[model samples]
Target: MDTMRDRFAPVVSRLLDEDPRVAVVLAEIGKDGFAEAMRRHPERVINVGIREQLLVGAAAGLALTGLRPIVHTFASFLVERPFEQVKLDFGHQNTGAVLVSAAASFDWPAGGYTHMAPGDVALLDTLDGWTVHVPGHPDEAETLLRRAVAAGDDKVYVRLSVQANRQGRAVDGERFLTVREGRSGVVVAVGPVLDAVLAATEGLDLTVLYATTVRPFDTAGLRRAVQGADTDVVLVEPYLTGTSTAAVSEALAEVPHRVLGLGVGRRELRRYGTVEEHVAAHGLDARSLRERIGGFVGAGRASVRA
Candidate 1:
């Protein structure tokens, strides 16, 4: 049950030590792990306490000065609260930055709705040229973080969750990787939800696709995967429901297809206990996923056997 956050600290410290142009901005989230990075490069590593707005604004300022800044905080604090700063300071300014977020979606359910950020991706979609990466495991997250730092002047958002798949897989960030092949439908599992999606579609006849990068979606890959198949695309994301519905529709506009989007449902305002409990409450558990996916692929009765 180790998290991407555990792997993130050491990587950030190493980056800070290696690159003088790279800076890390903290808003009171992972101060303990990044403490050494701050100690090594006090000029580059910055902490603004709990002020998320200034946290984002400071990163933007650093970007304006030809320095690449990696900002970290909770999803709610990083995106939902300082949206204007993200929109204007980064988007409007046309400055590039790597925004790293922990406790994405409902990872911190005990923190309540104030901490959960189901709509962060949707909000970022409203902006332009922002690359979003939802790494499934620590290895994937590390790859994406390195890429983001190497990618100069390109806005990147890395969403990290506590849940992880059993193993780590190398992510290319440009296309979807096929995990399993079937004849029924194509189930695209985004980031941390790969394990749950794998469990749900264990015995079903469906092609499973895993994506670490959601924005700049691989339309070509998806189109090729569903070339002669039943055009049934099911996108299972960790963010809000239907976050990629528009992109999926745009990608498959030439073909006739039915799409089903699944993630954190927005209807419920109440708490659903622990992270596992919240996942089940949103009908994202293996059983619920089996029922929904099976129903979507026309395997209603057969899905129950799993």
Candidate 2:
């Protein structure tokens, strides 16, 4: 099975072939994968060298011309580095572009803090009118990418990560899927963390809700899952901890509930290690998650910061 980034290039290549209105902009980060795409559609496939600002600015310029631009780069460079452009060029201008990001969180541990982007989703949350997609498997990534490209002049961000689940769920880029139905509590697994969440909550009577498109926050689905059930909710994401806790709170504002946000934490791990090592260090592995989730649900009041 290919990684999400591994599948992005060819998928966009096919999209370029199918849609004349679609365009791609890069900043020399993943240009090698699009060699064939560049050769085939030199005019549409753009590589703006190392200028992250130029990458987004160019894509916005393309969008101004009524073309749906798809921009790709590392999360740090794509969202953090050129955030001003993302705010102004896309958001302020009322122009929509599909911003696809790779290397979510600490996917590439050796790349150091500069390459990691655990705060990308949180930062984008400050802005309005942005649809965020975090796909756990390549199939889900492909589905979200296709939907983003097909979307007409809408600001969409599709987050791609190296970490993935063992299998892909049927994701429609809309609502959350109910993996398990229970009355104890609800665990919302976003992107790649479904398998670990499943392992952690094994034997526990809890509703495991899976999500691909997280920005919309599937309020109705979550309400239905917790209706007459345990009002306790837990969000296990692959990005910064508590990224979606606010959304969850707003979703259940009318009801009395408690939410525990779990994901990459604010503490920085300077040492460069393997991905698995980072997962363990951040307490995101199955063992740590099981302990934290069990404590939270059992005790009825516990704060587990990822």
Candidate 3:
């Protein structure tokens, strides 16, 4: 049950160990874990104090200087505290730096609202050159990280949860993982909600798509996948509707699709609970998903009888 951080550490460790040109930037919160991983390859670790803005700016500077830099920090701090810096310094300049956003969404309920970043994905997607990825499981996280690092020039934002061992089928070659067949009437989900969707529709004909890469979406693949099945499509995510879900809907305009966005509403998060509680409260749980699917398919009576 390795967390996204755990999955990322070894891949990053190997990258640093193999390539001297790659540098790892650690924010105040993620420094310990990143530092521990980079200990065996000490020369590559760049510990930047508590300044999220400066951390990203420094990573941009390093990238400009031809060193590949991976900036790590909590999602809220990474997006909010240094938004302008990220937009202008990295996004504008098209720096090849990668941002590994840890504790995205409600992953750290103990950290409270300030630490909870429900809008990070929304903010990042507006940027022109940046590619945003929200991996549902550890395997997807690792694959996305590898792709981000290998891209070399495109700015990448990776939203990762603190939870461990999420279930997702690995994608072939790319970070864009797919579960079920690439059939029509696909239900696209990000984060652990994919597991809920899979469990909810155990024997159904619906295609479940695990969108590991959120921004810079796989449009061609998506189009091909949904071309042959039912016209109805659903998109499930753990962030606000305007972010990933909106983007997906806009892309699927040719088809009859409905996006079932699940996340904290427009209001700020004011509750106290674990990630599971927050997800369930917002109707992102397995039971809730089953209810939604039943309603969507108009098979409530059949599901109830079974």
**Which candidate leads in TM-score?**
2
Please give, for residues 6-99, the per-residue lDDT of candidate 1 as tens digits.
9888998899888888999999889998877777899999999999999999999999999999999999999999999999999899998999
Summing lDDT over every window of 10 consecutive residues in candidate 1, give the lowest-scoring window.
Answer: 297-306
lDDT of model 1 at residue 206? Answer: 87
Q: Distance (Å) between predicted and true CA of 287, model 2?
A: 0.6
On residues 1-306, what C-alpha lDDT tens digit does candidate 2 reach at each position?
999999999999999999999999999989998899899999999999999999999999999999999999999999999999999999999999999999899988899999999999999999999999999999999999999998899999999998999999889989999999888899999999999999999999899999999988899999999996888999999999999999999999999999999999899999999999999988899999999998888777344322
lDDT of 3 at 168: 54
Q: Any runs in candidate 3 off by more than 4 Å, and if so which?
A: 36-43, 164-168, 172-178, 181-184, 299-306
RMSD of 3: 3.8
Sort every candidate by lDDT, greatest first: 2, 1, 3
Evaluate all candidate structures by whole-model CA lDDT and list the values in order: 0.90, 0.93, 0.74
Q: What is the alpha-carbon lDDT for the whole of candidate 2?
A: 0.93
Comparing candidate 1 with candidate 3, which one achieves the higher TM-score? 1
Error of 2 at 303 (Å): 14
lDDT by residue (1-306, candidate 3, tens digit) is 788888776788888878777789887776656666566767668787888888989898988988888888888888888999989988678776888988777788887888888788788766787778777778878887888888866788888886533555665333344578633257777665677777876777777777767667777666666677664566777777546666666678877655555555666657778788887787777788878765775443344459
Residue-level lDDT for 301 in candidate 1: 27
